[model samples]
Target: MTHLRAGLVQQPAWPDKQKSLAASAEGIRALAADGARLVLLQELHATHYFCQTEDADLFDLAEPLDGPTTTCLAALAAELDIVIVGSIFERRAAGVYHNTAVVLDGKKGRVGHYRKMHIPDDPGFYEKFYFTPGDAAQQEGLGFTPVETSVGRLGILVCWDQWYPEAARLMALAGADILLYPTAIGWDPDEEGDENQRQLDAWTLIQRSHAVANGLPVMVANRTGHEAAPDQSSAGIRFWGGSFIAGPQGEFLEHAGEEPTTLITDISMARSEQIRRMWPYLRDRRVDAYGHLTRRYID
Candidate 1:
């Protein structure tokens, strides 16, 4: 019965980079003290959720792959002797950026990273304007590949990618031991209460389904608090921080409230193998008949 203790940091971030990073560092330290071998932080923890509005100057917030955020997390992973997964706004080249999740092993520094494949351009979440969708051509087959770390093979994905089961399935098929999502999701402050609840419920339900289908544990870390738009064009988003961990059978291991929190739990890695034997979804898959999955539409 192999067990891995994992920690998730869900917190509010401010516009100030230094203050925001300090808050995240504090949570990482606390989790490490509690004996967590792996810690996952919310998306864009080093700064505010600036995607509320598309500003040309906001690109200034983008950083290189080995920039300050990765540097800071690598130091913490080394000092605490733990594996850390974090998200960053990556500046790949001039006028090209991506929403990337980075993984660091204890003393190994930056192990690998996954650029977000699904880019969303919704009312409040204007992500497509800033993030170029990750392409297999650009990464040279690294797209959707799980990162190998001391703790386990991390199937790391970003915020908007959480809604797609194909993304989760691809990671699972590629031999990911566990799935992790670093997210910045929330409700529109003006929406009716019932509608907001439905959205939140759907978000939780979809991710849990991934765990059950793949026979793996799923960890999600979301930011909390309300963030106003830079231009004040509309009512801002109230980030619902329901960070959680679900087991292989879609059972909740730990679930958090809307407030900022640090959640920790031990996941039974062997449970996945045991459950896969009982439910054998992989053995029953009809892969030969699903060739049209690559098509844009079946028309």
Candidate 2:
């Protein structure tokens, strides 16, 4: 483990898959030019917030594991000698799809994939309709699994998955060296005061806590800008941008705000090792008594 340069692509996405792909490719290319060795794209980088509506035709967007999108990204990774982590919609079969993050290593290796486990079903976020609940490896089925890349073992979890401490801990226990999340979260464009601040604070605090609890570096790349639905007149979700990188102690290294940009940060794997040694939370575990965590409530 040593110091390395990593990147986050935080651009506002589009409804057209081709345009979104091109937009993000530009960011990745610029980051590579900046000498980034690992690039993390925001969740579902090649589409808008389609999870908002669950039309059946949206299924067309889902691709096979080794689809055209992966082909392009693979070529990009090999050309730049940089690892690329992209969130994709994987069409498993006729009607099954998973919210997956596929890792393309520098050598063009299809490193691995992790489906999003904690799917959220909120007002603006209706993921349950499109995503098959991840059969995370920590459990029993083929859910979210952290991916390994040339930089390190990446604990890739999606947006809603970041809220759960258990999610991050399980990945760490399973040998993940870094915690990564590709997100799409924001406020309603009409939010005026304290309520908006609270939401943003909670979002940042929770993710930073993941790093604090696990003693690992955390990267959260989010979408920027606002996209309006065709017929809806309500305040659309204003993706607050603010893509960030946090150290083991939950210190912010770099963060981008409500704008289209790519952020490059220095990831010190050595620093994380040192923090883990001092904290030693992983060493002082009560794994034997943690079975109750599996249940919703312990009576």
Candidate 3:
């Protein structure tokens, strides 16, 4: 019976890179102390939600894949002998950038990275301006590019990617044992009461649906806090951090609050196989008839 104890690190992020990274390290250490074999960090954990305002200055925050942050995480994961999943701001090149997830395998070094494919260009999130879409097809986007860590294959995805069923399906099909999402999303300050609740509900429902559809466990670690728009300073985003884990059949396992938190939960690897055998949805899929999925509309 292979089992894993996973930790979700949900914490507030400031506008300072140094402080935020240090805080994440400290939080990770604390979770490791609690006997977590793997820990997941929130999206863009290094700094505030800079996408609030599109500015050329923010590009300085981007760094090479082998730069300071990834370097430190490599050493940390190795030292702790635990798997670490981190979302980072990557400067792929001068003009090329991406919102990517870095999987630091303590046993194997820097294994790989996943570039965010679904870049949301909404009011608060201006990711499209900053990120070059992975450009890879859905098959390449979320097909369980595991880090081959100390424990097992770590299937990690970014925030916006969670909404697309194709992404999650590809991960499960690629033999991912667990699904991890490092996220940053919340209610708009201008939105009213019920609207905020509705948004949060939809976010939770969509991710859980992915878990249920794929018959695999899912974990989400989100940031919490209201970061002022750097330019306006008057209004900003209130990150409603409701991090959680869902089991096969979309069962709610454990949920974190709308605040800074670190939680660990045990998962049974066999359950994935057991559930899949019973449901058999993946086996019954009509892949040959899925061409219509590519179309924007039936018309």
The number of clashing residue pairs in each candidate reads: 0, 4, 0
Instruction: Report the lDDT tens digits of candidate 3 across residue range 39-96.
Output: 8999999989999878988899898887888887888899998888887899988899
Assess every candidate by TM-score: 0.98, 0.95, 0.95
Two-way lDDT contest, 1 vs 2, winner: 1
lDDT sort, best first: 1, 2, 3
Root-mean-square deviation per candidate: 1.3, 1.8, 1.9
What is the Cα-based TM-score of model 3? Answer: 0.95
The superposed Cα distance between candidate 1 and the true structure at residue 53, in angstroms, equals: 0.7
Q: What local distance difference test score does each model get? A: 0.92, 0.86, 0.84
Looking at candidate 1, what is the lDDT of residue 225? 98
Candidate 2 ranges with C-alpha deviation above 4 Å: 138-144
What TM-score does prediction 1 earn? 0.98
Candidate 1 has which clashing residue pairs, if any? none
